[model samples]
Target: MKLKNGKMRKMMTVSLAATMALGLLAGCSGAKTPVSNQEKVLRIGVLYGGNMDDSYFRQQYTDIYEFDRKNVKIEIVPAINQSDWRYNDGSEPYKEPDYLDGMKKIMTGSNPVDVVVTDVSVLKQLIQENMLKQLDPLVQEDKFDTSDFVPAVIDGIKDLGEGSLYALTPSFSSSALFYNKKLLSDAGVEPPTDKMTWDDVFNLAKRLAKGSGKDRVYGFSFNRYMGNDPFWDMQYTYMAPLQLRMYDEKAETMTVESPQWIKAWDTISNLVKEEVIPNNNNVNYDENWTPISNDMFLSGKVAMMISESYYINEIADANTNAAKIKDYTPVDWDVVTLPTHPEKPDIGGNIYLNNTFAINTNAPNPESAWDYIKFIAGEDWAKLKSRSNSYEMVARKSYIQPRQGLSYNIGAFYNIKPVPPTNPKDDKLKQEKRGLYYVENLGRTYFQEVLDKKKSSTEALKDWSEKGNKMLQEIKLNPKTEFQEDGTPYIPEDNVSAAAGLSSKG
Candidate 1:
């Protein structure tokens, strides 16, 4: 996971890709003597989260590179930045740029890269700009089995066209309702069920928050940091599943003003008004609300919280004054699906909205890069990658089934069953909590606008529709074009250019 190690591995992959391209180009051009092995080296650009040692990101990059090296020669040049550069851009010159800045570096860097890997927000921007190479050729060549990947993940990678696929998502995170089993049992409350509605959750919240003043224990803790914090979390967890569509796919419009959205807003507002959940100010004090919520629950101060499944380990390990979580040996906490709206049974899990991989349009070795892409998304790599990260869920449906020789029992955490033996558990909680239906940042804004009471649900939806359409229009109309020093436009299919810009919207 070390940054240096990642950088080294990236260099190796990029070098190999370059080597493969040189040899391939020689034969295609009918050169008498093919290019020597020394001339072949491929460059790949990658922007990773956290440090190079970040288990999930590191394992992903390493697994793919190692797996592909045996079959193809390639080098991966990774630009690993520990700090997020986007946030630091305007405010602090000394600090790192946030996610966007980091992505731009990988996309527009001087080095010749065959593939670029990063998050959806960055990939979406590249896609809009037509910076990514269409992966249909690779798919047709049978380099990878696209059908093995989950439908939701495939949908995420495809453009509007039926055959177009631009990227691949290997893993992602989702939300779940985590509850302290002992506390719920002590209160004589039936553990939450997957079938529970928001109203049912509210009743439990009211019962859990019975004590007054200092002795009071709230039902849930949530943050409201405009777009990133509780705003998005609540939207994905509470609003979207209510069948509130933020944007109309066909019309390319926002629908924030819908009555369903209004109901969602009013429900959250009521919770705040009744003190069932902490207000925005209280929750915002902590940078990340999950830890605070975990602490509160582990300490026997809160009854339940909605959080990422990865937090289960932290909660089970945390120390608390009311009851030492560790002394209980193995913790007795359980996950439940986030409450659903009465009318929206189909709506549940959020989709993966994190880092995905795309071929750079200008990559020197497209074929070999596709090979690596296939390897990364293949069964061998998927199984190895799954064992390396606790937070990530493999996007391939085949990999989701039980696998032997894994370092940990990952299936145990994901194949969770509901408590109290009520009907078939269906493992809905695990599915929903595995990056199944994520709301975008723009979607989050609509939720915030509604929650803040600044706009009616209908009005918010209208605004979102306008903004989303405008953005999509800008992307479609402004096709990205690479140019030469002579100022002539460069078409990707006919020309090879060292300098190119990949553009797409988040």
Candidate 2:
């Protein structure tokens, strides 16, 4: 999440009001000193997904800041976790306020902020609460064209009501299955097919699990917490092929109890119960998912794992700790889209995770803020991000290109077709891999929440279907509004029935 200037100052004003009432004017006044016209600083709040020095985050910040420093008068005050914020200057690191506190600090300030950037979900909350400014008028006056933006990315940022657009998605990612070539070969089984079903994966896991008891190797591992929401992740990756829609379009209700969802959960439960997968205790973040899956694959202790594309590179490139597995020897392993359910071949889509950006409604200078937004969305930014250590596929259709010396391919895959520039070098491998797409995670939250309660699969699905529809209705009933004289819009009471009346159309 990133914050632009205008909203931060507003939050600051609101936060200081009580202090002013209590006669603590000295502190509030000190914090509200205005910046001189000569000092043009853009204060932004950002969520650090990786190390501050990480190439992807580093390059994005460098490019934007460098451009802003020279091309426009600007100061960038970034708010990130203190431990994560790094700079050569001796200044202390920034700290994140709790959600409400942060909102108050930015909303009611005397020296109001200029602009803000963040995620769609956060922006949605602010927009509904009348804490954000609509970018539509600014875009219209500035003639900002969205033609170059990906449709899916744009759709992800729009308010559920279709009338307003609150944020811009700059980049995106989806998860896939990463397997160890040596392990599969040693097990006498071929690599899992792009079209394999969950049952097929389970059978292969049985074949791949090796060793006994204390020395036992398990076939698969995933996080298990009510908060973890494997139900949504697994359903999107596996049941998508079954064409399972949790919410009915015409009826406007959840369909989680559908046969497809039940079947998917039952399959996972069987795997857990049968010991085909390691027990939950074996699934620690350090050992199971993050660097561990990579470690296990490299050491031949695990055959295949479900993870993002970035993890594959991290494992294969490790020199000191994970140099043992034959597959970890760069160029030995490969990636394919997550397997789909057998019945609904077209059901699942790519599960894009991190590639997103949003605007703060409380921003002071949205016009100038767009300059940074446009810069990050350009070809140069995409190329830089793609080449960074955390190599992510660019979201734009025009930015795909072949880079020299890199062994792993970086391109989009939808239903097994490699959508890349027509290069002969890229053709042969296209047939072996497929790409899947998915809706944003928010769309599936209901099923996830229900599943966490240890409810029957059928009950969870039904609950999600009802709750999802209710949420949709709320969004539909509450259309976005222009700013009022007070810089705030009147908020309606929570009305589930009113929200359900909303159409899911754009």
Best by lDDT: 1
Q: What are the lDDT scores of the predictions, listed in order?
A: 0.52, 0.46
Stretches of candidate 2 exceeding 4 Å from the true structure: 1-39, 47-59, 62-97, 104-109, 130-152, 159-164, 185-190, 193-200, 203-218, 223-265, 280-294, 318-331, 339-356, 389-393, 397-506
Report the poorest 10 consecutive residues by lDDT, candidate 2: 430-439
Q: What's the CA error at residue 491 for candidate 2, in Å? A: 34
In order of appearance, the predictions have TM-scores of: 0.57, 0.53
What are the per-residue Cα lDDT tens digits for candidate 1 across 384-499?
44554555568766666322322322333223211111011112221222111222356566656665778765676666566655543433333333333323333434222311
- Residue 408 C-alpha lDDT in model 2: 43
lDDT of 2 by residue, 273-328 (tens): 55555543343333334333435555445566665555555554553444553333
